[model samples]
Target: MKKNIFKIFAALFFIAVIVSCRKEDPLNVDFSKLNIDNPVANTPLDTWLTTTFLNEYNIDVIYRYNRFYHGDDRDVAAVKVDKVQPQMQTVLEGFLLPYRKVAGVTFIKKYAPKQFVLFGSGSYNPDNSYTLATAAAGRNITIYDLNSFDLSDPNTIVNKLRTIHHEFTHILNQIVPMPVDFQLITKSTYLATWTTKSDESAQADGYVTPYASSQPGEDFAETTTSLLVYGQAWYDDRANGSTAAGKIALKAKEASVEQYFTVNLGIDFRALQREIQEVVRNTYNYQQASFPYWLGQNLYKSLIVNAAGDPIYSAFPLSTPFSLVNNNMKTAIAALPYGLTYNFMKLNFTSSTAMDIEINFNQGTRSFISRYAYTMDLDQATGQTKFTIAAVGGNDASWVGNANLLRPAVQPMLDYLSNNTFVADWLPTGVDAVNYNKYGGFYVLGTPANNFYGLLGQ
Candidate 1:
């Protein structure tokens, strides 16, 4: 009925147009009144977007502000022409490439959002909050506050990427449902007035952030995306800061997210995490994403140096000061009256302020362990740790007999550790991502070539 009514109205309009046209001759009609210029003419940005996004992935980038793209009530600004490319460059490197590396090019091309809409200013809310990003129908992602973007600021890059990943996670959930087990992990704690809650408070209740407490869907997205952008170190810091129950809940959610990506999506989340962290470290140069940063956070409890056996120590060229000391200790211990061979040394970081230099040795079938305690002054900001030997000792008979007997032999290694301040860092540059966490060591602050690295363990 509506279609027939529209057709009748159209016929009446056509008759009126014919009568009007008869009143004026065809040549007399004015053509200059019509506007003929293309409003959507291709700019350089358009051409780049076409080749980079549209041509490669069938994605459309709409930076020209159209009021219809946003809500009627909200007043948003158009994206600055210059800021568009840099913002999208981050999207390409930080978001798209990580997934491409881990999940494969085809997976992202299949599941990635079809359109991106950029806005200069934020999409403000009546509640005094603003939207950073939003996704619709698994097809469109709109990012706001592009005018304030700073490519050089790691936090700015991370914040934008986090929101993008968060929205993308929502898109993925729409395609493949999030695990029901994730929802049940913190079911009773969710709040409708989540805005009133602080992130600290929400984290104590097992939510990754305050927004996550709003719903189970947001919880899953926050947990997944936070890990992806902030890296595992940030997640570990949050988990460690939570209450006992909250820690358990967060860990459970992490496991669920791992399972979701690994089992449901056929993506290795850890491998994806490594790829993303590499970008965070190398591309963004985020200090918190580095291994040394986590070491200071006490994420890894111990670092073992077995120079005589492990080849990685040498591969990282840990041979200079550390290998020299390792071989000397072996020689000195071998020269003892009885048959004794040197074993690996372990630096047990008992706490942020304390560590134990545990020296191990073998005589025939028996292994003797001696421990010397030291207080550490760690400047986490500078990645430097200063060690000072404790005046007292609770040394057992083994330490008294073996350590005292071998003190002159091991004093050189002891002085090497205690005499100078060292900068802690991951030693292997350009090594495989799998081996990143496998080795970390310290270089003497003033003398970098005098450094030693070892296998790390929790």
Candidate 2:
């Protein structure tokens, strides 16, 4: 009986220990304070980002504020939601499409930056200079200054495009290193404190810009971006204005860049340049930078009209107008008793302010010529030129008889030249941008439809 009682006591003790350890505390926590909701609901911008960039090219455009994506210490504002789409559209036109045409869509898919992070405010630096764009590991690009973006403004568009191209060039360099000779061209000119140097000084040292003097990598990027964005005319101006050694170095660097793109990247750099210039001229309306506007020579030795089936023949044909004037002169000459057959006519710009009209005709298998002189009031600033009769026979009194003999036919052509103020242009809208300087002509200032184009000459 004692043994049985001890066993019961031990079992009772085990039960008490188990009950003490399993005691339940009062539940005082409030469930109402807990927060739970879906953070992403497929907003339009989100959907667009996914569809246009991500789905199309495997690119992620992050315009929303995300501290993890930016520098830890820098204060950069997120891109305005409204500004995001327009900015991306510019990117699509100015950057992506150009590359897609020249380098191929496959090239963009393979080499283009995968992520693009945008900010509204400039990335201000301690040096008082703001960062326009940056690339990291050839995978991501960060663009700043979207708050003041103006899509309609050509300057704004070009500035943004320059930054984009500059950053992209860095990514390209990361993939396939720029030619070592590019670095060696201006090896001794690079500066650690490049901010101290002016752009003029940088050009003097063979660097394209002050920032390019920071390092060889930046030099490469700047050079490539400038050529791509500014076109060949600007480069020529820069080279022409640079020091002798700078000009040589700049040319070498330019050649090196062309070689790198052609050999390393398998891209036709000239075709790419032409393609970019076409957009700059046609889309951006940068006509002043075209070839014709910069020609130092004022004389046009020959005028060749665009024939039938040409690009501008249907809309703005000079051939028809020229033929009418020539035929009228022919009929008038045919009525003359000299038995002269009308041959051809020429407009010679002998000087900036002087021109000669040469009337060539055939009399009994022998050619005869008459020259008429005129003065030109050419306002290059306004691209308007006015012609006035200086002398009917020019410097030869003997030719005065022929000038008076053909008065009826010559008077009409003469009146046309002296009466109309023709505006000189490279036919910016009609012909290819590649032929801007090679061929151009003058149209009535207010009446573009009344224009005539020809081979621009020296």
Candidate 3:
């Protein structure tokens, strides 16, 4: 009986210890007094952003100041409310539309950053360098200096578009690494203080820009952005202006960049550049109707005709027009009168009222062709165009008599071109609406009372 009582006591003690160690429910406390604000109401800008960016590409844009989106110590401010729409519109037209048209919407949808953060002020560094734009982790882009944006000004618009392209290129590189050969092109020229270098010096060293010399990755991005932003002519001019060795290296880099887009992304870089340029012109409301525009669209030529409306010494066939090919004049030699063969002709515009004209002539079985250069000038006030022989070389003397025979006929056409009142229709045909090679029309010189000479652009 005593043993049984001890067992019951031990069991009771174990139960007590288990109950003490177990968690116990305590008194409930009221926490309703804690203050918490509701979410801010969506603004019109937010609605627009939702429709433009988020709805289209699932990308978010933040124009309002948000501390979380910026670096802790960076000097930046929120984009001005008024500049936001215009800036965003410019970005869409200048940057995004080009990629969409060239690379396809799906490509951008997949590769574009998920978010864009805009700032009114540039993120200025202690070293006097300013950050224009940057991509972060391939997920976000931050564009700076929106407050000073002027879409009406082509230069400012181009510069801002360039920054966007530069950052976008970085994002693209992050997705698919640039070729290792690109990095090796100017590997030794990479510098920590690239800001100190001048653009000419950097270009001479095979770098597209001073910032491009900071690193190989930046170099690739800079090269691509420069090509896209400045267009092909500008890029070619810079490359050709560089030293011979530098030109070769820069061209190699360009080829690599182009190959990266073509082989890897299936994109034609030139077509892309052309598309972007068109968008830029349309977006800026550029005046495409002017004398300069007409001049660029048409190929000008002078024709010599007799009283019976017959050619005396036409450089090209009566029907054939001279056209610009690779920046040089070209025409067909399929039809020639008097056993005359087509050679070459060039027109270099020195200014609004002056041009340097060069023409070459060839005869059957002749060892050499005759070449002559002439200075063509226009008196803007009087609207009179005059041509004076500048330099005569090659076998040109042999053809001087034939040329002189047609001088009387050619003078009238020259007078018509010089006349400011002369009315001529310029019709441009081709992809760009200004490709003189494809369908350059003729200019009707003189009235029916006088012999008509049709001067065609070849």
Taking all chains together, each candidate's TM-score versus the true structure is 0.82, 0.69, 0.69
Q: Give per-residue lDDT, candidate 1, residue 367.
A: 92
Clashes by residue pair, model 3: 321-458, 322-457, 322-458, 323-458, 383-418, 385-418
Candidate 1 is scored at a TM of 0.82
Give the Cα-based TM-score of candidate 2 against the true structure: 0.69
Tens digits of per-residue lDDT for model 1 on 224-253? 998888876688779888999999999999
Sort by TM-score, best first: 1, 3, 2
Which segments of model 1 are wrong by more than 4 Å? 1-41, 306-321, 338-341, 350-354, 362-368, 373-402, 418-421, 430-439, 444-451, 455-458
Residue-level lDDT tens digits of model 3 in 1-458:
99999999999999999998989898585443341111254767778878998899898888768767778888688787778778778778888778888889888888888998989999988899888888989888999989899867777777888898899888988888898989898888899898889988988888778898999999999999877776544565567778887788788999999899988878777778767766654556332311223333322343222212323223223322222221122222323334554444334444444443333445566633332344555433222344455544333543475445333323333333334233222223123412211222223234312212222332
lDDT value, residue 270 of candidate 3: 70
RMSD of each: 7.7, 9.7, 12.9
- Choose 1 or 2, whichever is better by TM-score: 1
* Residue 328 in model 1: lDDT: 89
Worst 10 residues of 1 by lDDT: 30-39
| RMSD of candidate 3 to true structure, Å | 12.9
> Cα lDDT of all candidates, in order?
0.85, 0.77, 0.62
Off by over 4 Å in 2: 1-41, 287-318, 322-419, 427-439, 444-458
